[model samples]
Target chain A: MAAVVEASRGERDNQDQELVQRALTRDPAAVAALVRRMAPVVHVRVARALSRRRVEARGRDLRADMEDMVQEVFAALFESDGRALRAWHPERGLSLENFVGLLAEREVVSILRSGRRNPWTEDPTLDTTLNELDTDQQSSAEGRVASRQRLDQLMDRLRERLSPLGLHYFRLLFVEERGVAEVAEETSSTTDALYAWRSRLGRLVKQLARELDDEEEVSDE
Target chain B: MSEDLPIRVAQRLREEDEALDPRLERLAMGALSPEALAELEADAARDPELARQVALFRPLSSELQDRLTEQMSAPVAKVIRPARWTRWGLPIVTLAAAALLLMTLRGPSALPSYAGRVEGGDVVLRGEPTPAAQGRRVMRGDSLLTLELSPATQVDGAVVARAYVRTPAGARAAPGVPEVDPSGAVRLRGVARELLGVASGTVSVALVVARPGALPEPDAAFAPSEGPRLEVQLLLR
Candidate 1:
């Protein structure tokens, strides 16, 4: 039974290699097959990323942007003499499919990361509102100053609450822009554990923000 | 050189894949030495289709991290603290605040509380299920409860880890979990009323996706960043 399974696995790997080789030659049929085969995988990754994005952004629609991300992944894989695809060395242990998948994952992560940074880019109306606010200098400047003060207060509170390790994690991740693996290694934790700790901290801070908002709302009322 | 990053990212991303299917935990954990990871990579290469599914989920993993940072570090975010009073005085003030909050939450609404029945066909939100509307009321009887997972993305190929409906009476596995297409629209036909014995009050619907595996318990509070689960509560009239 194990031998039968191994035989099938070898056969599948051979087929994958042929497809990728043909694809590298820019054979339209091979390229098309590659895309058709990979599209769902790409779409799913992009879709999942966007879905999480929609949630974090408070339920804004992100579907319209999905195609762009998927296309970017394909382009990266097939572009420049199929550099990305050619780089896949099955002999080294990863199959061609997984190699391409790596590309798709990277593309989706890049898109999600960028969207998180600006966010307004995902919705033009938000950008327009900010532009409008900028033109209204007197009120905007006053608002900015007030916002800065609030930020200072929030940071002070955060510093007080975070453990020394947590604070260092934050600084390394955000301020220094270190990767999760690097930070995890430095902290003597797995990436998953680091994620959980960070999430716990964020929830605490968000709760604090929520209470402040509630208090202000009551005062206004 | 740039290729190095994706490989590392892919190694890290197995964390999500493992969450969906514990069998992949070996890959998910960075426990593999470089040589071992390479062998695993070769194995993954043989199955591009599987690799793609696993890769697509990496974005969700990254998003979870992004969300944590976004929530806590946003400029002008505030943190509230109690006034500087005696410890006992603070507790008293906190108790007063808690009572006030409870009152506000349970306060009368424009819509009535769940009387234990939904009157109409299930209200479905396709492509993107929004958060449940609290004040919204539903009729109790003859209502078919349905949920649409939005941006159904990979649902067509996704293995349903577990799905069900729950209510005050009890919990039951849904007769049919969401059926999705390539367009990422999953339609779960409603048998929730029967399964949940949901004669009245509130019914909670939950859907969790994973690779094929043993059925897991339903998580009502599941969020995407928590892995692949969607949950919404409906208040019936």
Candidate 2:
């Protein structure tokens, strides 16, 4: 069964390569075909990314925003003489669909980051952690020890709150840091199901963080 | 410290999952040989980022694949049937001919069109006089410009208007978000010099009206067939 799936994937990759070559030569049919094939994949990923944002959609229709963003993703691909599309390397094992999905995810992230008014208030700890990750070399030994202790405490609380399956998911998605598709396949779950789990996990983490903050405030007092 | 620790750790770990690498994709797809896979796994153990990437690679679902294939089955454009016009072709041709005849008999239909001209720093209806125009040249020394558009015919559906300025440098979309009045007229205000850019030659401003989602690219050449369009040329001194 695994072999059959791999064979099918390989065939599709070949067809995608042919279509891409035709698209690069200014073939209108190829361009339209490529857009039609990839739009839904791009749409799904963009929707997922937008769902993860803390900011409200600001009374704008999210479906419409997704559609426009999907168009922007295609425009980026086909623009500049299809420079981004040409960069896809199937020979190296990256499929066109996955490549486009990755691009869409990155674009949505960039858009959300740019539109952020106040980064600290939105998700301060996580934002600070990401910033620190970028400048890890500057951290003092004391800071590192405190950070490690906090991480261990958080992990213990998470283990108590989450079910075994949920903990496994957290391990795969956060600790191991796998892709949604990859994680879904390993868990024998659908992408939609995995996304739901992710959202639930995010909410749980935020709630726990707040509780921890309250405890610290009481201790400080 | 403990309260925020869990969320921050999770986020940092997730953030460490870098962009998809082709070799990592191969590992996920089971394309790598056993030895290669072991070597990659060993390397990933040493590198947290690589471990995250290797874990992240996976193929799209069969449902998505089916959707893509279904969409690709349809042709991008309607097939022109000049060579093979045998069965359904004659009827299609007759229907097209009848539609053309009806259009010709009805004369030009009342598709909405716009008329615009510069009055001092303001773009208004062609016949309207601006107070600034009486004292100064229309296109000179104006820091800001107002563009006003009104449909010449009754609009049946939602109409959208976009404005562009063409200069020796090239064409660019005029600044300012368009405001639509209840009467189906549209108005935009932008800086005159900025709209014209730094080019010191003939400048043309175009106002295009179309149904929602039908506007052409800002830099694309104006096609009347696309929608009702109006252009006014100004010679800069």
Candidate 3:
């Protein structure tokens, strides 16, 4: 069954790559196909992200905002000689739809952040850590293999500290990279409750990090 | 100093991970067999990260799939209407009419010249033509516009084409995003109302084809330096 799934994915990847290649060359049919195929995925992702915001306060219909966002997402993909389209690496295990969906989420997050006066008040170090981790993943293969044991140990420690619900939140927000509203909906919780949980989790993770650092210091001494 | 530990842990986790498995995505969509799902869940039990992944995939995939199906099943007119003219209003009618008359008297040559290199290309105006054949081709208010790139000008890189309708009020981006047919011909349909707006007179439809970054800005002067461009004047009444 896994083999069948893998085979189907392979076939779909081939078709996606072909369509993307044609789109890169501005082939109208291929471009149209791509827009039609990815628009809904982008729209869903954007809408999910926007669900956290007060759309009513913004004085625009949610559908209208979603429509504009969808167009902007496509514009970004086709801009700069299709630079974003060319960045898709299916060999890395992400399908084109997922890739575009992820891009849409990031775009919406960026837009949301921009609307705020001080978006960085919630742990300015988090972005830096994410970027550093992303760089590590891209730049080192042997280092990654060597780090597997450490990663497993860390995960074990983190799991020990978290309750079952906290663990679920970790999985949804951090591991699966889902939007806050979607995670809240899945867990049958309100966004307010989820936000509280997220803040608590952040503090817990930081505390655990401090404990690990203390342990290392004691061992060194 | 303690803050550095989380970053270190994050780096290690990222390094240890490979890209997401496509099979997991299928499982999330409920396409996997019962046996396959059982096997996946068993594996997930040991791997907390994978377990978390499995937990979220089902809802995420289901939502996206449902939305995609809904959008695909929607009628074409309904889909196109909101997106094309969401920014336009009826207040521009008088200004657009005056602008059209001025452009009509100025002749087709009065349209901005393509200062950039012009490779051979053509903009074929589709729909029924009016009896007035003097200055520019007059078409009914509902004509579809077709843009065809000559075989010689089809280049190797990303060629992007954008259409703009120039009126006295200014240039409004034509509502219909161009779709290419199977034969490589680009078609912009259902844009007559958008291009004509509420005012009907002489409208200049400028089709700009260029490499992605070189495409002309909508409100700026229509001078591009990268690829072929075509302009056509239409009398819509």
Q: Which candidate number has the best DockQ?
A: 3
TM-score of 3: 0.31
Task: Evaluate every candidate with DockQ and list the scores.
Answer: 0.02, 0.04, 0.05
i-RMS for every candidate: 24.5, 22.0, 18.9
In order of TM-score, best first, we have: 3, 2, 1
Per-prediction TM-score to the true structure, in the order listed = 0.29, 0.30, 0.31
For candidate 3, the TM-score of chain A alone versus the native chain A is 0.50
Error of 1 at A107 (Å): 1.2
- Tens digit of lDDT per residue, candidate 3, span B40-133? 8898999975665565444233232223323323333223312322343343445346646865776322111121111112223344332222
lDDT of 3 by residue, A122-202 (tens): 433333544656676765754563344344445546655553345556656666667789877766678898788766766
Better of 1 and 3 by DockQ: 3
- The model with the greater DockQ, 1 or 2, is 2
Which model scores highest in TM-score? 3
Local lDDT at A36 for model 1: 43
TM-score for candidate 2, residues paired by index: 0.30
The better-scoring model by lDDT among 2 and 3 is 2
Model 2 residue runs over 4 Å out of place are: A1-7, A115-221, B1-237
Residue-level lDDT of model 2, residues B6-41, one tens digit each, is 457776445433433435534433234446567888
